[model samples]
Target chain A: MTRLLLPQIGVEPPERCDAARNRRLLLDAAALLVSERGVDAVTMDAVACKAGVGKGTVFRRFGSRSGLMLALLDHSERELQQAFMFGPPPLGPGADPVERLIAYGRARIATVEVEGEVRRAAENSPGTRFSAPARAVSVTHVVSLLREAGVEGDHELLACSLLAPLEATLVLHEIRDLGMSTERLEAAWEDLVRRVTRA
Target chain B: MTRLLLPQIGVEPPERCDAARNRRLLLDAAALLVSERGVDAVTMDAVACKAGVGKGTVFRRFGSRSGLMLALLDHSERELQQAFMFGPPPLGPGADPVERLIAYGRARIATVEVEGEVRRAAENSPGTRFSAPARAVSVTHVVSLLREAGVEGDHELLACSLLAPLEATLVLHEIRDLGMSTERLEAAWEDLVRRVTRA
Candidate 1:
């Protein structure tokens, strides 16, 4: 026998657990809205309805539409972060470093295809561009991969040079303004990865 | 005989030439201010005094401070465009494609070191990002160089990826937040150029 004293020491507060679940529920609904109807259709009322919660719950969780969009972006980016860090195979682990780099860029381009508007909104600042925690994680991952692949020279800057093309702001522009396909972007990313990692 | 008739047919207007010279003079003063004390030090009053003109002249040429910054950015970018398009050797025409590409990135980094703030202001919107005439010219130049170097891939997108790191927004962040020197950036750029252009 095992005795459970976790609840007594506040291991799980019911109210907080409920709040977290509730917040995730709302975000899931918002993500669905983005995928189904696009980012422009993700109004507060629409999100509330999609989540089957009252409008007050939506407003309480996110102060405004932009706030909701930002939260949604954060959620989506975290999902991507998890995919690369811990998921499986080429994007995660158990793959060649060069292949992983290619997969990572492909995944980033896919994310931009979905959540680009939200990502671009946040990347508007030149000063804060590289300071985001997500960006740091991505850079660290790329640098480590470069080391694993036996590529020489300045890894940090090389990571940045590689990551620059995958940025949502630039990706969105390439797709919308320049009329480029994400397929083409992915192929180009692979070419870049191979070129940079070549012995 | 032909020149005598040309003046009567509205050729080389005196007022327009004076206006063009005045605009150039004010822009020159603003560029000097930028080089000496940075972009923040450039102001209507400073430019007016630096150009030995009245404040009203500066105001008449550029409607506001933001307007002045825009014009200054345009002026500087045009100068760069001219250098790469028609000027001698390395960056322009005579050098090998790979060498020209390296010089172009280095020159762009140098320009960003000086005119970065102004350039970043214009790149704020993702929609208009690749639509700028200067950006188009740069892309065309890079694509031509890639083709000339016989690099096999999507030339347009490869050019875009090559050019992404040279953007003022990313360059400024790498310098300011990441504490990277421009010299290091230039060297890394050369490495990337060689990698992409390798046979």
Candidate 2:
């Protein structure tokens, strides 16, 4: 008996699969360049060379240097989001809300250490600073955590207050301009969270 | 006895007085134009026209539009500094530290409603954002207030966190982009101050 074949629902086409892999490869190479050298070193030609792809492929994927930087920011933000949303322990679901809040601040500060330049570029643009989707998700998460901790009074505004210091622009200034250590920033954040959450 | 003395120390020469008065007049005109018509309407020609001075006088006083904006910001910030440092209670001395802190935030938010465009422009410049002398003074004031309130643990960083949300760029975003009422922001700030100071 002959059987009819059909495309699987909710599945990516083979071309899309190749496209995804290609995008991932370029981003991974860019990330490596940023880590090893710096954000300035992650040029399109460098990413293409590192990814073993043609320069045209890199350009086609990311469009421009800024486009690549934005995608890199989105990629790193998504990873952090996943960890805090689904991964185990303090940043995720298992721990108390206050602890989770502390973890969130720590995680955000850590991101500044790595992705700061890109984040600062995005922040310097007035249009993207507060309106980025990732920022909205972060605000929502902080508000929920504040509610979970039983803190009252304008949780949304409070979340904005809490997140403002962790912004890349400010954190980077503290770290780079003022010579503040990341550990000190993290400890201060923990202290802040505790104080705000104290009953 | 006739005081045949070296020019009285710290006294302006008559010609210098004229120059100072001219500068103040130009600045006041620019400020009035900004308030009545918004920042974009406060051109050099307009300031000259408003002040009843020659356009050359405005140009000679400020050099350029950016220089005028910076001077305007400096003028406004100094006024704020004076108010909080010595002007009256609630915002100045004689009030409780927490009340002063709350007043500080309210004053800053109010400034955003007026001088936000100019302040945001200054903030977007990397050199000016954190390193401005005015910011340093403001930070020192907040840190002292926190200490006076006996809130412990990283008072400097905590002050920064508290001040972050009151940044003109962020406050303007909340007021203009998100359409959040200034009253709501003020109430939320009061809530934040109480939470941080509650022991």
**Candidates, DockQ:** 0.63, 0.68
Query: After superposition, which runs of candidate 2 have C-alpha atoms over 4 Å from their true positions?
Result: A1-15, B1-15
TM-score of each: 0.89, 0.90
**What's the CA RMSD for each of the models?**
7.2, 7.7
The CAPRI class of candidate 1 is: medium
The TM-score obtained by model 1 is 0.89
What is model 2's DockQ versus the real complex? 0.68
lDDT digits (tens) for residues B1-199 of candidate 2: 1112111222234557788888788888888888788889989899989999889988887799999998998888888887877769899888889999999999988877678888888888877898877887788888888888888778888888888888888998888887899999999999888988887
Model 1: lDDT equals: 0.82
Clash pairs, candidate 2, are none
- When only the first chain is scored, the TM-scores of the models are 0.85, 0.89
Measured with C-alpha atoms, the lDDT of residue B121 in candidate 1 is 75
TM-score of model 1 (first chain only)? 0.85
Instruction: Give each candidate's interface RMSD in Å.
Output: 1.2, 0.9
The residue-by-residue lDDT of candidate 2 on A1-199, one tens digit each, is 0001211122334567889889888989998888789888989999999999899999998899999998998888888877877788799888989999999999989877678877888898888898888887888788888888998778888898999999888999888887989999999999888877787
Number of the predicted model whose TM-score against the real structure is largest:
2
Q: Taking the tens digit of each residue's C-alpha lDDT, what string does model 1 give over B102-180? A: 9999999998877887787778765446676778778878888888788999998999899998988889888987799
